[model samples]
Target: MNPALRLPAAAVRTAGAVSPRLGAAVAMPMFAHVAKPRPVSDDDAPTMSLARGRTIRIPGIDRRGVDVAVYEWGRGPRTVVLSHGWLGRASQFSALVRELVAEGCRVVAFDAPAHGGSGGRRTYLPDWLATYAELQQRYGGFDAMVGHSFGGLATLVATAGEVEAARAVTIAAPADVDELFRGFQRMLGHSDAVSAGLRERFAARYFPGDPDPFSWLSTVRRPLPAGAPLLVVHDEGDRVVPFGESGRIAAANPGAAVLPTTGLGHNRILAADVVLDAVVEFVTAEVARHPVSPTTEAAAPLTSRAEPVGVS
Candidate 1:
């Protein structure tokens, strides 16, 4: 592939969104081909446990008596906020957080409303996006963000407006809104119209706007800011989300780099050595160039063994 066709580190750091229960339609063939069985629960899974961090209530912008959980750790000048995939909690990113904290970076993660320790019925894209905005107000600006699945999609939308993070990493995220919904519909044995209606109901009940319903891949219609970088990682063998979705984001964003791995599908990719290393290196290089603060120390260099293969 031409280097110009690749996504950049800054842009990759800020991509992706999460999805709901693994659709049977997408899971059967996909996971069977490349993904390991997911742990029964995220907290019980070894890859996602970070030493328990502090969780605080962040105000919700649109509702009354609502709050979001923010998990905070370390005291480094640079901060990384983690957003988990569907049904995942802030703690699912423990391994990544632990690694970054050890490198002198601060981290924050959230249990989207209805998941993990947060409140509400299961959430959709809008509320999560609002919660994202509200959380930014409380936590202040971050050096970068890492979002998986739905969270990745939310982060991309959130970044487009008031969110201030400069870098992001999106993992195994779906690209097109219609495709994602269709995938869910097929798994649930619902008609296209029925699925569309349910989606509208979910969005209206949980959020404020008519769902754009476009894929995140479609959302990236322009290149990332010349100064910002993005990294998109996916598994060609992923069963839950098509690898081509990630390709959409890479193709749309002028310099964003895409890394399609052989294994480590979906959830497991969160802790895959290459994934972690790629995230660390992307954030580290940007922090070095931008330098969150002159006094902030970076985490130790990630070893080559952990770096994503064939990624610049």
Candidate 2:
């Protein structure tokens, strides 16, 4: 269960007229600066020691074009998909991707809808899940997946029922979607009614299946794929995503393991040695134990879900 905390009064004060849309413009710059993603080359592949891979265009439900970046390397039979957090590009995981590739794992990542090179206005959970489904249809089933922050939540939803992945990993992911809506509303100083209205509209338009963010915390829990292993890592010191989120995930899935960490807040966990190592170890171990069949090796999974926790 998610450990409860008193919501800070200051965190929810009203601003005169800042809208969620406007708040994004103001907050994105701040998030970009603090995210501190390393520079990645234009191609799907890594430069220097890193190899560039492939890019594919997926037609969106809205008739818009969406693109996903794919990177491949190593001689291993296993493939892994890495999903970045909110407002983050797949390249943010380049450091960990390189490490995984060196270990003989083929890695793939997406820019999401609006972030990176992909085209869109604001993104929602449904958009992500649709793109994820398209990729899975093309790539088949992946051995493991690692998602950071919002991507972690999306990954949980994406992998449920549709994907055939053997294991999953979430870093600083949220346990509840409502917490995110609340956090954003608080950040922008929106009134509760206004925030609820805006969030409901956004989800209905973009994320069709998502339950009311408030009720989904308990209702929309992402169940682990049958027989699939799960590992969750979160930092207690995370200022963005509370560590309690990870606790909820662990509580929901008895077979899932949780690693509570310290110091690394949200994005920094991407670069942290301990966190990446844990992910790599988990993926490699799962792959070794349940090796992908030779014929169906190159494909990625449909999607899966685990309980979500709020981290914003």
lDDT of each: 0.57, 0.62
TM-score of each: 0.69, 0.72
Model 2, 1-312: lDDT tens digits are 112222322222322135645433333322222223335555423432354556666544344565655555565678787887776777778678778987888787777655666655445455556666666776677788788988888777655545557788989898667657656654555456556555555555434565543443331354554445778999989877778888787776677878878888887788789988888888888443233343432233322221111123
TM-score, model 2 to reference: 0.72
- Candidate 1 C-alpha lDDT tens digits along 1-312: 235323321122122112222222222222112122133364445533433444444333234334566667778888788887766677668778877987888787777666666665434455555655566676677688788886776666555434567787778876545556565544434344444454554344333342432322234542234445778989888877778889887776667777789878777888788888888888766442222322222122111101111000
Model 1 whole-model lDDT (C-alpha atoms): 0.57
> 227, model 1: CA deviation in Å?
4.9
Model 1 worst lDDT run, 10 consecutive residues: 303-312
* Cα TM-score of candidate 1: 0.69
